[model samples]
Target chain A: MNSLEFYVDHLFRKYKASIQIQDLRFEVLGNLEAKVADLTANGVGYDEAVRMAKENLPSIDHLIDGNRTIYINQFRLEYVQITLLYMVIGWIVAMPLQFIRTGFIHWLFLISSAIIGVVYLVLLANRKNINMQKIKAFNLNAVFDLRKQVWLVWFIFIGMSIFITTALQFGSNIWFFRPVDISGPYQFAMIAIKYLIPFASIIVPVIFHIAPKLIMKYEVGENDGYKE
Target chain B: MGDNSISRDIIRGHIDAIILRVLCEGDNYGYEIIKAIAKNSDGKYELKEPSLYTSLKRLETQKLISSYWGDESQGGRRKYYKVTSLGEEAYEKSLADWKIAKDLIDKLIERQD
Candidate 1:
């Protein structure tokens, strides 16, 4: 590789690689080669030509659109970690209430939430070694993967909520050691809706409205390091 | 290079138009486009590589220009840009606008002795 290519590669080494970035790198390298060749033909020494080519490209930040950059900061990851930790704590605290009034499935669901949160925290911690200094261009694949993960989490939570609420209402027929009259699926549906009403009404809305603001609190400005 | 900075700033806003004007002659690649601009301006203005790449990207995104990979006969595969029909229209419009602006600025700045 020429000095120009090596220089460009070194500058781009910190970014997460994607097809778009690869194409851009190739384009830049080819142009720099052409410029260096032109300069050398004009009586500039090979080394000086390469240096001039490098000097001409002061910054590559403009090569990618501002909106597409992924500025990986400590704050975004930490915010997610804290949010997951709070979820685990909340589920564990709610576990005792499950024993008094709810069935075994409800208790299992609560435990599962805590376990999932712990697993997520472990996975997140493992990813902490990434360099937080460099900003990178958007990776479409990563965005799609994250979307799939978010949907999977939502599906799992909602499915568990439905199952636990249904089990709480119909899984047993004993109430305070007395024989309780059992209704059909209609009554079970009513009970499930009753229990889920609080979750759907309150928790979901809170997550939608408040979580974004909370996460935004942790965002380090793009200009953080460059400030005098 | 004292006057170079002010001229560069004045020219920066119309970089897209300038590029489109170059591509209007024929399909061209990055270094060639820079050379063309420098030649046109008698070496007074040299478009920085960063600015040129950014403007080229923006123009491509706007569908004002399209690019293709040239055959690698010249050691490296050059990405050549062509002015689109929309780009030609944009260039014409910008040229007319610049004409009016230039005339007005000259009249305003000219000394009345």
Candidate 2:
């Protein structure tokens, strides 16, 4: 690696690896390299060109767009908590499906869901252990990006619920040596609605609405300031 | 354009506009834009790396300019920025506004003699 690339990498070492950050790093290194090339072309020594290039970059803080920074580890932990909570909700909604099939698998799923919920609660209790040094700049775009992901998650959750519940209703009957029952239109419609009851887990995305608030809680206090 | 600190501060505030003005001529990359600014100012002003990048990013986010990576034909892949139609309109508006401001300031700060 060239001196300019090394210098730029050293400056960026503290920030987490992300697509946006990687792009920024590429842009910064390319520009510095170009500057050094220009100076060296003008009869300047290679080492002096590197020094001048480094000097030209007074600070990179302004290039990172955000007035406030948040502890990235804590923010990630929040997403994990959110995922576990959704699992608990899904499994809870699926619990009632046990009445329809009457099986050991349903009991296992219900127990596992309870365990996941308990794990989420425990993580929430111990979140104070997260390091304060892992910082990420906070911006409104991040919130919007998160909302988009949450919407996708909800979409997948609902789609899977419909699929699983329908599979359980039809597939289980055949699994136990029973015929695939397609009675009348009325019975079919009733069964469809009955199996799709797990869609009630749609309430999980409500956490998405509250996610911005949760993220705000992990923001580094103004007094702590972002370390360079 | 002058040695006056106040003038330099005013120029700094309009770095976005200045960068836009350069792109209005043709699409360019980061180092080239900095060089163009320095050359236009007769080497009087050299834009700092941080300020140039920050302005470029802000302008991109504002939809004033869009960027793409050029192929590795030259020296590696350089990010070239092009002005959008929206950017052209913004540059015109800012140029007009600066003209009026310049006129008013000249009138207000005229020598008493």
Candidate 3:
């Protein structure tokens, strides 16, 4: 058999997936070449090294290719969580402010907070296309859609936290002018949630995004599950 | 591509045995071992990269075979693997088992005819 035919047959046995034959060829030949390079640098003869590489591989090409499937799944989970977080906060703000006929500042707070959640959702969804192979695209789209809805939830929660803070500030500012008041405990918690939730979620995404990259960097390439 | 039930089952049966036996000869890398199998099988048997790597990982995890970085530089840096004493023992047992299996299957096929 010609070299290409031999290699193609070898690849077909291991990786039966429907990708192009050239892709298969590259994977096999590339890995073989790497081995040849390594053995040559170690003072091994070219023929000896080639022969060595030819004898070693035992039909596991799919491990490397299958990784993309795994990574897409990881992305799916992250966006889903982001979606749920947003949904909860949206309902909170729409509840109280729906009827409150307040001044321009109150409405501004409500409107901007609601819009901010949707904005966060848009940014995430717009960042990537769901054109992943093997991963269901509709499920991926649902993740983004859920994200949009959840952001509304988060925005509402954010608005409540802010509204409470505003109320506290307004209450405290006026308290000094009043006859009396005791509001130390209320001050403590509002400031805490006011500063904490966004930071927590921020760090959460950082950890989420950073993990796979770290794994990739340190990952000595081998059979990583998506070969065939 | 669709249903690989039979192929996967056969490969799984031979995977650990193949890896251990191959490593018994000398240290090797992923692609090279696969190539060797193809050459030995005369193009009749071949392994996919995914299945091979998974078997390699299983062996490595079991401490039967060990892999190290090779200094070879043809296209990419390769991880070289060698069979441990444990792997050698495992290989021998598996070899015996395979012989018995081949005989049984051969007899069954002959009987069918």
Question: Best-fitting candidate, measured by TM-score?
Answer: 1
Q: List candidate 2 segments past 4 Å from native.
A: A67-228, B1-3
Candidate 3 per-residue lDDT, tens place, B26-96, comes to: 89887778768867766656676556766886798789998676665444456678999898888888889
Look at candidate 2 and give me any clashing residue pairs: none
Model 2 Cα lDDT, one tens digit per residue, B3-107: 676667777789999999999999998999999999988988877776788789889999999998877666545889999999999999999999999999998
Instruction: Supply candidate 3's per-residue lDDT for B106.
Output: 86
**Model 1, A168: alpha-carbon shift in Å?**
4.6
Winning model by lDDT: 2
Q: Write the per-residue lDDT of candidate 2 for residues A1-228, one digit (tens) a residue.
A: 767777888888756778778888888877878888899999999999999988877446545655346777777667667766666665665676666563344565566567766766776776777564677665645666777887788888788877777687777876787888787996786687665665554545665666677667777663243221
Off by over 4 Å in 1: A8-22, A58-148, A173-228, B1-6, B111-113
Between which residue pairs do clashes occur in model 1?
none
Candidates in order have lDDT scores of 0.69, 0.75, 0.57
Q: Which ten residues in a row have the lowest lDDT in candidate 2 chain A?
A: A219-228
Q: What is the DockQ of candidate 3?
A: 0.33
Query: To one decimal, what is the Cα RMSD in angstroms of model 3 from the true structure?
Result: 12.3
Worst 10 residues of 3 chain A by lDDT: A132-141
Query: What global local distance difference test value does model 3 have?
Result: 0.57
Docking class of 1: acceptable
